[model samples]
Each structure stands twice: as structure tokens, then as C-alpha cells.
Target: MKSLILYDSMGGNTALVAETIEKALGARAMATDLVKVDKDLDIDVFDYDLVFIGSPVIDWLPTKPLMDFVKRKMKAYARQGVVKPSSPLLPGKFGVSFGTFAGPHIGEKEALPMTMWLNSFLEHLGYAALDQWLVVGRHHHNKEINLSGRLGNIEDRPNAADLAVVEHKVGGLVDSLSAWCA
Candidate 1:
């Protein structure tokens, strides 16, 4: 099995989550790689059996770059495959999405309103989202310390305790993904 993790982070929270998932999967014969989302990303997604994407929630939705990456990548996947009569966008692979919010105030309320939109877009592009998750931590927005609905007063970046929760969540996601691939 092979897996890839693509992410865009402002405070490295999302990157840490991706790493946790990769470690938890522990694929013996898997080739796993992580990359920061680039403007001119030229990755080949067909080679991987599983993919994980992490993005910082902006304006209660995924950042524009993340959304654009999803759209472009999915479209590229579709373009490389045989086009069906009705459906045009479809990938030959599967993937998942994750977001990291501040503290513990992550609800569908405002942290990630674009979650569904991105998921639907993935499906439209032919990629199957294996699972989705959200993590809580400290994030700065608009140059101010803004908690995306999470609790606790974070004076600085997430400490070991905060990272542990993210690790646990990602570990679970990895377990479920491994079982799914099995």
C-alpha cells in the first residue's frame, strides 16, 4: 500500500496531524510521503492507495489554496482517466480530509463550513473521502489570537498536551483507514 499526505498550514498544526496518521498506519510495504501544498503542485495521485489532506480553516471554510488544490487535482485525475457519458470528474484513488482548529471549539457551526463543499467536490471529481476529522489547538487569525470555537486560553502554541489529542485522533483515523483498505 502507498499513501500521501498533502497539507497547508499556517502554524504547523495540520502538519503534525498528518504525521500522526502516517505513523499510526504503519504500513509495512507502504510508501508514504508528505508535501506542503504548492501553487504549482505536479503530483501523481494514482500511485497511492490512500491520501490525507490537512488544511487550516479560514473564514469558516477551507483556505482558497486548499480548495483550489482539491479542485485542480481532482480535475487532473479525471482528465487522465476515461470520461464517462455523464460524469466528467472522477479519480482512480481514495482520500480523506482533516482540519485543525483552535483550542476545542470545533463544530460544524463556523470552523469548517466548506467541509461538505470540499467533500462534495471530491466526489464530483471521482475521489472517495475515506474519513474526515477535526483537531483542536491554538491558531492565529487576522494577526490576532482567534479560537475557532475551541476552549481554553492558549497563551502560546499548543504544547505536548494539545498535540497528544491530535495524535490520538489521527491514530484513530489511521486505524480505520487500514481496516478500510484491508
Candidate 2:
């Protein structure tokens, strides 16, 4: 099945996560496409069987560019009647939302709001929202700033530990998809 990993990263944390996912899926022989979200990128969300949308949380929400792309795609889906409640959801279509945050908050309190919003948007567009991932990233610009959370002082976040979890999640997702298809 074909997959897509689309992301926006300012400090490169989210990009690393996106690329890691792409690599993991490719290692399993799955065809995957990676795109860095930008004005020049012309993405058709319906072209893929599985999609991973990721971004670094900015001000507790997706970056403006990411939100703009999502809004635009959602509009197109709605125009095509792909987002209507009556349209049957595609059983094989799935989406995962991921985010990196430097906020000191723990657990769901940190990134659930943004990630869940993303998941809901994907579901609205007719894809089953499979899962969400939240990884702690370092505050690259300045850890001294009060806004930087728990691991803010540390550089290289979404670090080794965070990446291991991402890798494991990808493996599990791939295995589950294989089983479902089989």
C-alpha cells in the first residue's frame, strides 16, 4: 500500500520524526512518500492509503502553514462530498497525527489537544483516525525562556528515547495494517 508522511518543522525535530517513519515503512517494503509542507507543495490527501501528518506544536497548535494546508484540503474534500456523513468511510484508509512539543506538561495535557484536533480533521475527511503520537522535543532557540518546558534545556530532543518509541509505534502500525490486509 502507498503511504504519505507530510510534516512541518521549524527546528527540525518534527522532520526527523517524519523521515524516521518514512524510513521505517520503506524498510518494510511499503511505498511511502514524504513531503515538507509548504506553499509550493500540492498535496492530494486521497492519493494515499495511509498518511502520517506531523508538526511541531507552536503556541499549542499546528504551525500556520500546516493549518492552512489542512484547511484547504478539507475544503476540497467537502466540495467533493468526501467529507459528508453519508459518504461511507474507507476501511483501508487511515491517518496518524503526531507532534513534538517542548512544553513541560506531561502526558495528555501536553499535546492531546492539538493531536486530537488533527485526528478529528482526518476523520472528517473520511479516513479512520488510527492513532496519535506526542514526542517531547527540546527548545532549540532558548531554554532560558519560561515557555520551554521540562526538557527545554536539553538539546537533541525527540532524542534517542523519544525516537525509540516512534520506531516501535511504526512497527506496530505496519504489522497491524498487514494483518488487516491479509
Candidate 3:
């Protein structure tokens, strides 16, 4: 099955995770498309069987650009009459929402809202929300937060160990999807 890894990163942490996910999908012999969310990004999410959407959690929400992208897509879907009141499931379509958060205040709690928001959008579009991943990332601009945050010393986060976990999860997801499809 084809997959899409779409993400937005401000300090490269989220981008790294997105790349790891793309590599893992390739290792599983899946055709995958990696797209960085940008001002000119234009693509149909329905073209892919599985979509992985990610962003860095900023102020307990996804980065503004990513939110804008989702809004644009929602409007387009509405105009096309593709949005259903009940959001009936579209067979063979699935989505995974992921995010990188420093969580200076409340640990993983800071990232949950962002993940849920993205998943809600996917569900509203009729794609089954398959999973959510929250990866700890460094608050590069704020040394105090990076050193004393709830996660503690996350400056080197989304590091190799974190990426390995992401890869392992991708493999599991692929296996699960295979079984589910069969």
C-alpha cells in the first residue's frame, strides 16, 4: 500500500522523526511519499492508503503552518461535498498523527491536545485514526526549558534512540495493517 508522511518542523526535530518514519516504511517495502508542509503544498490525501501526519507541538498546539494546511484541506473537502455529517469510515484509508513536544510544563500532557486535534481532522475526513505518537523534542531556543522542563534535559531528544523506537513502531503498524487488510 502507498503511504504519505506529511510533517512540519521548526527546529528539525519533527523533520527528523518524519524522515525516520519514511525510511521505516521503505524498509517495509511500502511505497511512501514524504512531503514537508509548506505554503505551496498541494496534494490529495485520499490518494494514499495510509497517511502519517506530524508536527512539532508549539504552545500546546501544532505549529501554525500545519494548522493552516489542515484548515485549507477542510475547506476544500467541504466545497467538494466530501465531508459527511457522520464521517463514515472509508475502507482502506487510515491515518496516524504524531508530534514532538518539549513539554516544559506538564510533560506529555502538553502534546496530547495537538495529537488529538490532528486525529480529529483525519477522522472527520473518514480516515480511521490508527495511532498517535508523542516524541520528546528539545526546546532549542530556551535553554532553561530544555534543562529543567518536565522531561528534563531534552536538548538531545528525538535522538537516535527515539528514532529507533519510531522505526520499530512503524514496522508494527505495517504488520497490523497487513493483517487488517487481509
Q: Quick one: best lDDT, which candidate? A: 3
Q: Which stretches of candidate 1 lie above 4 Å from their native place?
A: 26-29, 81-93, 103-108, 141-150, 156-162, 173-181
Where's the lowest-lDDT run of ten residues in candidate 1? 141-150
Candidate ranking under lDDT, highest first, comes to: 3, 2, 1
Best by TM-score: 3
Model 3's TM-score against the true structure = 0.98
The runs of at least 3 residues in candidate 3 whose Cα sits more than 4 Å from the true structure, single-residue gaps closed, are: none
Model 3, span 37-109: residue lDDT tens: 9988899999999999999988878989899999999999999999999999999999999999888889888
Candidate 2 has a TM-score of 0.91
Q: lDDT (CA) for every model shown?
A: 0.65, 0.83, 0.93
lDDT for each residue of candidate 2 in 1-182, tens digit (9 for 90 to 100): 89999899998889989988988898899999999999767778889999999888876788889998988888887897778885457878999999988775553366777888788878887788899998877777765632445544546677788887898899999999899888
Measured with C-alpha atoms, the lDDT of residue 156 in candidate 3 is 90
Q: Which lDDT value does model 1 have at 19?
A: 72
Alpha-carbon deviation at 105 in model 2, angstroms:
5.4
The segments of candidate 2 whose C-alpha lies over 4 angstroms from its true place after superposition are: 86-88, 104-108, 145-148, 151-153
Could you give the C-alpha RMSD of every candidate to the true structure, in order shown?
3.9, 2.2, 0.8
